[model samples]
Target: MPWIRSHITALLATLLVATYAAATEPPLSLRAVTAENNEPFNIVFNGKLQGLGVDVANEAARRSGFSLQTEALPWARALETARQKPDVLLFTVARTPEREDWFHWIGPIAKREVWLWRLRTRKDVMATSLDQAKQYRVGTSHNDAATEYLLAQGFEQGLNLDITMHDRAIGYKLLASRVDLVPMNPLSIGAFARESGIPLEDLEPQMLLISSGGYYLALNRLSKAETVAKLNAALVEMKADGSLQRLLEKWQPKGSKARSPSSPP
Candidate 1:
């Protein structure tokens, strides 16, 4: 009877230690980079960083008992942070074949359609094919996945493509007829145009470029798998509970509606 009591006492001690260890462990700490003015997804307004992506990341952190730290930076530098820092997260990134291996991905946060847009005034700006479109000047960003996609398609910089760091720059250059066309996502094209003070109607979608993928929250590939797994599980629950859907609906730009389920491409 004494031996049996001792065995039970040891088993109870083991369970208590395990529970204490789990509770005392530090929560996962994450670094996230947000594009400075990529509205509706990530934006700083009234000096506060806010957007659908912002809300999603914060909610995931809370659900997983993780701590989230975010910084607003230019897209170029943000790309560097996501690539180089494990545990750092990037959002609204297109999950393309070229980017599938870059990060541990979560959520098709938004549906996206990349388009070649040109001014309605320029009748010569239209191109029926990407190759034909390549014959005209196109504004793209350096190290951007879209730029990489175009380059892989045989577009050469300077010869027919002009690369820049600012998304708004492309829109402005196109308005001045500096670049004949620029790639834009339908979800944010109007915002970009409006940011540049260009009337939305002045821009017309010409060639519908890549539209097969949507944006995702990506953790650096070197991130701890267990931590990433917890965050992803939380995100999956959000999606199933329609929390993710509601976030999209809440942040959708005026005039355009959020898709019932975001369409790929």
Candidate 2:
């Protein structure tokens, strides 16, 4: 009877240990969403999602002991879904004052400069200052932070602001002279021109909007604090180890050298 009692106590101790481990373990699966049509950052190629943001996030999730699944959506819809759903992840989002409190901020995986763009041939259109830029119609996408900055500077819809849901359409409108200016990254010049069926030399940066703005991965506000902490730690380790920099170099655009992962091109 004494030996039987000892065996029962040992079995109960084993069960408690297993239960405690399960309760304390972090979740091993995650869902993330990104904006479509953003090449080299969050684009789909050959039916698979692969880009700088995708690659960086996948590596970070692996280091954090999690598996990540990603979906590509329209920019505004992706922003909305990540905000509304608990634990959802969004990546490569510009860190702006307007968006600072929307989610738990993660690493600034990439940095890019935004500028007002125009046709290279349009020498007559001058945007020497923000006020001068306001005199001309500017193309913008829905819920874009750069657009928000312009609005804060007094650009009004249907007046100087030409708004659209498809980001590529803004480039097309700029090509056709429907809008005098549009916000763009110089790095995207070749890709956008190709997508718009124009020559790469057609577009040029008119005026700088955001100089080296940081873009980060964000998790929903409802995510567990531990989840945020794990991801944050993983990104920090990756940066420190130079693995993040090497990964960015692997995806660097053709004909251009890669810059530091934390620095803008």
Candidate 3:
């Protein structure tokens, strides 16, 4: 009877180990970066950081029982830090083949559409097709994925500018008839124009450049796989429960309507 009991105890212990491996694991810690003064996507308010990407990251942390620490850094620097530090993460990154191997990606958090926009007064810039728009100079951000794509396609990159400088420069050039077109995201361009006192009506979409790929929460390669896996599971849970949709609507820019499941580009 004693031997039988011993055998049963050992079997139970093995099963427990297997169950533990399959269930939700314990908490972990993560570091994330955002712009020093960026808003709507990630921002600091009342001494606390909060925004769409922040909310998503916090939710993921809570569901996974992890602690999140966010810091404000320049866009290019933030991405570089994430790439260099094993503990760091970057959000809302547009995934590309070149970046696919850079980190462990965990999402398609948000989506946007890139566009070629021109001043309404610019008659020569009007185009029925992307090929036609290629004939004109398009203002773009240096080191941006859109810029890379445009360059690869033989579209002449005009007035290389940083992300922070692109808006004002683009608007001035458009109004002064310097550059033929400026490539930007619709929602972002609209928001910037309104904030800077530029009339939105003056801008017209020439051609849809490409479907902006969804945003992602990426982990550095040196980060623990178990930690990343837990966060990933949390994301899947959020997506299934419609929490992600509600978050998107809450943070989306004014006058921009939410896309339905049935809508086409």
Candidate 4:
């Protein structure tokens, strides 16, 4: 009787473990996506997604005990699809107030600043304030949250704003005087300029557009709340263990690099 009682207890423990594992194990694979050609954040390297954002997401998913299947999509498409779909993973996203309530947010995975860059050679072009800078032709990336933030601040296109395919291309447009000004961040701007044969010293941050914001791993509004919680927990652990810091450093650029992005809290 005693042996049977002990055996029943053992069986109960095994069943409990199985149930917990089932509850916590992530789905076979989750569809993950990041903006196409948005380097240092999301980009295909050697035919695979391998950027700071992708690396961080992969680690977070691993810590959470799941696997992430990543895809590269254009900025606009990535945003729209993630907005409409569920359980889809979108990362390295800047958390904005206009979009605060839309997604199930998970992190301050990274930090970046969106600033207005102007040609240093253009002495005739100087603005002490954003309003003064608004008078010139400004180039921005399509669907970039920084652009949206500017829109919220009354930056108008055609009249003054020029939407471009790539935010980094704005640097080229500026060098050619195609646009008087452009909006970009430090993380990839230097590389963008180098690739375009434009000197980094030629451009300078003229205005602090978005002081600072956290880039997050955002889930669609329709995602399971439990799933969100699981991802968040894994991320919290990452931050606690210093893996997050290491990931940031791994993506940190070397020579001919732009400004370094600060760590998010």
Q: Any runs in candidate 1 off by more than 4 Å, and if so which?
A: 1-27, 256-265
Q: Which stretches of candidate 2 lie over 4 Å from their true place?
A: 1-27, 256-265
Q: What residue pairs are clashing in model 4?
A: none
lDDT per residue as tens, model 3, 2-101: 9999999999999999899767565566778866434466766788777888899889988987778788776778878888888577876667766777
Relative to the unseen true structure, what is the C-alpha lDDT of residue 7 in candidate 2, on a scale of 0 to 100?
100
> How many clashes (backbone N, Cα, C below 3 Å) per candidate?
2, 0, 0, 0
TM-score attained by model 3: 0.78
**Model 1's lDDT to the true fold?**
0.82
Residue pairs of candidate 2 with colliding backbone atoms: none
lDDT of each: 0.82, 0.82, 0.71, 0.80
Q: How close is every model to the real structure, measured as TM-score?
A: 0.84, 0.85, 0.78, 0.86
* Stretch of 10 with least lDDT, candidate 1: 256-265
RMSD of 2: 4.1
Worst 10 residues of 4 by lDDT: 256-265
Cα error, candidate 3, residue 164 (Å): 7.4
Compare candidates 1 and 2 on TM-score and give the better one: 2
